[model samples]
Target: MSTHPQSQRRLHAKGFYDEFPRKGGTASRATHYCAGCGHGLLHKLIAEAMHDFGLQDRAILISPVGCAVFGYYYFDCGNVQAAHGRAPAVGAALARCLPEAVVLSYQGDGDLGSIGLNQTLQAANRGERMAVFFVNNAVYGMTGGQMAPTTLAGQKTVTTPNGRDVETTGHPLHLCELINTLPAPVYIERCLLTTPANIQKARRAVRKAMEIQRDRRGYAFVEFLSPCPTNLHLSPLDAAKFVDEEMAREFPPGCLRDRTAEVAARPAPPPLEPLTPADIEAVLDKCVAVPAPPGLDPDFGTIRIKMAGFGGQGVLSYGMMVAGAGLADGRHVSWFPSYGPEQRGGTANCSAVISGSAIGSPVLSHLQVLVAFNQPALDRFARDVEADGLILYDSCLAEKPTTTTARALGVPASRLAIEAGLPKAANTAMLAALACSGACRVASERFSDMLAQTFAGKPALIAANRRVFAAATEWCQANLRPE
Candidate 1:
């Protein structure tokens, strides 16, 4: 054997996976980051600290949308991927939910400083029990080397071809200084990773941040002045020199705030309780009985309904009523709503599933009952109804549907509601038609109970809705066939 010890021959963090093959198939040992990038070094340091502290099992590494988005493939511990600039919020939630877990939020300059500035500030301001590692590479490395919020003044980037201009683009953001200004953060430090001495200091800072988190101390932020050689158009050695000579002058790596000694450990969170039927009943008010109507096909116990209309037409509420009726009748039910950008005068729709058995999917492409409140709504969703299904439309539509596969029924729902002195109850009139026409198996008493529960606060409108429901039921009974 060679004279060199096993440790001397090779070194790797126990907390890190054996290989980073996903980063590149060519080199199983190497990472995907560009040569001279600081992310690899930072990752090794953080992983080593976690391993040395015996926190590998209890650690949760949160990687957001950035150069390190694929960190889950490297770290052996519990990993959570987050949306761009959402790592801090995810880390805060994990820390709160699992008090014993050591949470780590790793993010780059663009993600933490720009789009996620508010989330970062809020998490720090609350003194969340976690550690945040901010890598300042002065450019968006992963997404085509764009100019980031922390890009140095006079620095040249793809967006800033000539150079970063202070007059047009603001100055480089100093995260340590900004976070230090806050009262909640316990420890805050800025360190460079270019030189050997600086690397030792950065390693110690990383350990200290993790140690603080282990003790349940409040927020600790460590800013690393990292390099992005590929984006900066510099060689690996030149990138280190640039960070040491030029970038360090602007950032000034040092401790901005240290309150670790003065702070106490946070209190442990309470244990979660198991959900009980009594708890469900207390929250849901009550559970009634479901009796299938006579006209429904006994072969299929599930009813998929879709309601589409203008935003002000109460399409969402109409679906909710069906779902609520199912819930009250002790059936499995789900309701989902979708709408356009504009709240009113815009198209809106919702899907609901009311079944005696378990609900597999909340979304339905083929609806058994479709209620369309407008011509556009009818045109958009009429084709999706099953061939043997029912299509109910408001009589106010200027153009009627041309679907020959499904049974089409046009009712004066809005006109009847206005006649009953409640123009806004058009949705209830359609629901009444659904109930009386035997399209839905729900009883009128259950619908009345749901309306009572829905308009409990607005008791005056409940009576008008009952009258509208009665009129629609009578009209459906007189004109519409049960089958």
Candidate 2:
């Protein structure tokens, strides 16, 4: 099934989600990645676990930066692209949002050790109800060769061109030794992805992590000392040999923590008043704020939406604004985001599902409305809209396409936002038009309240955003003219 570079050009193309399997299959089959990159093997193991468990619908994956960033494009389950070092934070939120779903935090050396050190360790120590997978590739890839927290003493990377000098660069980070001190995790193991025999052993560790999730156990961690040939500028064979000879000696593989037996036999943590969403979701199947007075509408047909656009497009914050309004209206709400490259000039997006009953299966396919900021966004997702659905776009760009089944509207949102005094308020403008299409029953007052809360400290700028939403509403009413 393997093909040459020329034969797999489409697979290597940026934004190319190469494979689309019909059923239980290795969902990540597109392999244009540098040969011997341990990320590919790890991705296969994780995806296989997800599919084998038949928990695809009830699984939330938090994909970190580094080579693992594209984990979402192939996995059939729900995936969240997390900040470089904050996969654990997103994993914590996943446990809060869908308590029944299996949540996983996939991270790497530079991300977990350098930036996300605090988050990963804290999550493990406090026993955050999620599983975290650490990919310990001694050196950092993607961002050129650089000495990572786990880099061997003599390894040469762009940042450590003279090979890492222990005096200055210091020694490799032993995460297994570090996390072993935590009390609550169910299982912890270090596995190496060196050969077929070792790969099989890693598979057991992968299963153990998933089993912990299945049993509703607390925190679990598995760190894999992997290889990176592209960054090392070594051949596949040489890289694997390097991992065996150099990497394994510095950070040997084995279990670091396990409390599954104790956890199962021990009593549960005492319940407290639920203030945070995580506490609420953990305590109840669904969570909603105290209802408004009797006059307010008590029930609503929930509409789960996934919106995508360019970075700084406010895709996530705007979705939060809508989720906040849902709370104001006494409706149950949940907002999840995909970070990482989105924060770095790439496309950013989020999924918001407002519901009356408790929400289930957050994997969304047929949204009622699709919003596109650029042509690529539209081309990639426009077809996912349900029949008779609606599409909205920025008319200023020549990126929009004519939709037959769904009503498509292009609005001069950025220009209008500038007129409204919030020059970078295109997110609000675009969302207002989508709301007008009955995608979200957002009221002006509720939106104003969200605006106030969002800009809580910036009182001087409140009027500008207030006028902005009002203008967007007026424009929507004039054009959409919802009858």
Query: Best-fitting candidate, measured by lDDT?
Result: 1
Cα lDDT tens digits, model 2, 144-206, are: 668899988877888888888999978888998888877767788999888999899888888
> Residue-wise lDDT of candidate 1 within 184-266, one digit each (tens)?
99999999888889999999999999999888888999999998888888998999998998889999999888888898866
Lowest summed lDDT window (length 10), candidate 1? 291-300
| Poorly placed runs, candidate 1 (over 4 Å) | 1-11, 23-26, 274-483
Among all windows of 10 consecutive residues in model 2, the one with the lowest summed lDDT is 15-24
User: For model 2, what is the alpha-carbon lDDT of residue 324?
Assistant: 86
Clashes of 1: 0
- How many pairs collide in each candidate, listed in order? 0, 0
What TM-score against the true fold does each predicted structure earn?
0.57, 0.54
lDDT of 1 at 58: 87
